[model samples]
Target chain A: MPPFLYIFLGALAVVSALGVIIQRNPIHSLLALIATLMTVAILFIGEDAVVVGFLQIIVYAGAIMVLFLFVIWLLNLQVETGPTGHLALKLFGSLAAALLVTELFFILAPPHLQVKFTHEPVGYGSLASLAGTLFTDYLVAFEVTSVLLLAAVVGSVALARRLPGTDDPRAARKIAS
Target chain B: MIPLTYMMSLSAIIFAIGVAGVIIRRNILVMFMSIELMLNAVNLAFIAIGSRLGSMDGQVIVFFVMTVAAAEAAVGLGIIISIFRNRETVHADDLTLMRW
Candidate 1:
């Protein structure tokens, strides 16, 4: 049963990942991302880390994806041509992604790393333990994340309201609401 | 125990797919999704290692990552909306105002 769960979760992750890449429409891409996030959350669950899994679903699959969907709906964007038209931008993006992949490979490569997954998974730390670690070890990051959210709220509202040269009430209300 | 090599290879393949998407796609939103794919690929590595190491710290960090991803998506989508309003397009080629 456990092996079945593991294989199922892993396959879901890969399929949804492909879905995210293959879909062209932004809304469709967002939907694919939601599926991928959900599958990732499920993977956490299979690992017996229920809290992380739930948070993954709520924060990523729920709140974040809804925000992305709202923006996509608001924009009503038409599908654009492929990046093949712009060789420079495509080249730059490819180079950046390649650099990132290479860096990641170095970081996770087996010889340099000591940690390894074994047959016996560790017991989950209690929620209180998790919270304690988060506060003491990651307090600054926690506070900064809140500030970032606030800034995003303010910035989004502000950006949504701005008019090039004239005041626009519809735009203002759209932003305000 | 599952073979460590198999797990690593799976993650590597997934990561490669994400890199390809970011490079090949022109839509900024789709590009953003590709970024999410990359992040998830990383998360898989974290969890797999966490289980191997007999610790939950990696899982805990995954929790933190999920939070950051949410906040990032909010801000990124916000910016996308404003950009779309200004140009009425999401094409990579059309983002030339800042290009040199």
Candidate 2:
């Protein structure tokens, strides 16, 4: 809620995001991503979205990150070495990013475009209110997401399953032993 | 009260970093992480705007976004694992099986 807290957490999120981009090892990048997710959760809480903030932690930082780590270990990925693009491509990418940032700055800088924080009802971001709206108005969407998640689970399993007589060394070893 | 512009700007900056990551990183996993970063940046903007306007819709949308992100991560990692099984590499550039 405090201005200083926002500034501190925002800066930390930015730095961690940079770490995600710069780290050569995917494992290190995953760690940096965890930091970024945590900071974003804190920022969400600071903005009074308590449910979303905690959900960000439980889902994104906890479950999703563990999944990422599991995949990294499963594949046993090595250090990335370097990107495939040449120097010219890299320069062009940087230039494009810089231009995008500049454009965002100009769009966000107008004095008259600021959003006014009006008086909100008590318990605006409370769990009760969120649940009420979600169940009544967004129920269809909520149910659809559940179905989508189920589909994802099934699809992932199907894709990752090994076929019979595949040439995978690990599979062959399993059959041998 | 913190200015909404500051929060939005911060989100924009992070979004730019995410774009750069996607463009510059060759590892598919890291590129996926960058995409997550971009999603979070949008979530930040959504929450900020919702808070400023005294509405709850933005937070609700964020919940959906997080759900979609979770599903995407699952399916994507599964595909990556499949790719690794067949190709034994994770570099985006090395995935040329579909190319002519």
TM-score of each: 0.78, 0.93
lDDT of 2 at A3: 90
Looking at candidate 1, what is the lDDT of residue A147?
84
lDDT (Cα, 0-100) at B73 in candidate 2: 95
Model 1, residue B95: displacement in angstroms?
1.2
After superposition on all C-alphas, the RMSD of every candidate to the true structure, in Å, is 4.9, 2.7
Stretches off by above 4 angstroms in model 1 are A78-113, A116-126, A162-177, B1-8
Pick by lDDT: which candidate is best?
2
Tell me the chain A TM-score of model 1: 0.69
Considering the two chains of model 1, state its CAPRI-style docking category. Answer: acceptable
Off by over 4 Å in 2: A82-84, A112-116, A164-177
Looking at chain B only, the TM-scores across the models are 0.93, 0.96
Candidate 2: the clashing residue pairs are none
Residue A10 CA error for candidate 1 (Å)? Answer: 1.9
Candidate 1 lDDT tens digits, A1-177: 266776776787778777776775667777877887888777666655577778778777777778777777777765544433356755665576667667656765677555544554334545665676678787887787788778867776776666678655557667889
- Please state the Cα-based DockQ of model 2 relative to the true two-chain complex: 0.72
- lDDT tens string, model 2, A78-125? 786655555676677678789999999888885745666775568988
DockQ of each: 0.48, 0.72
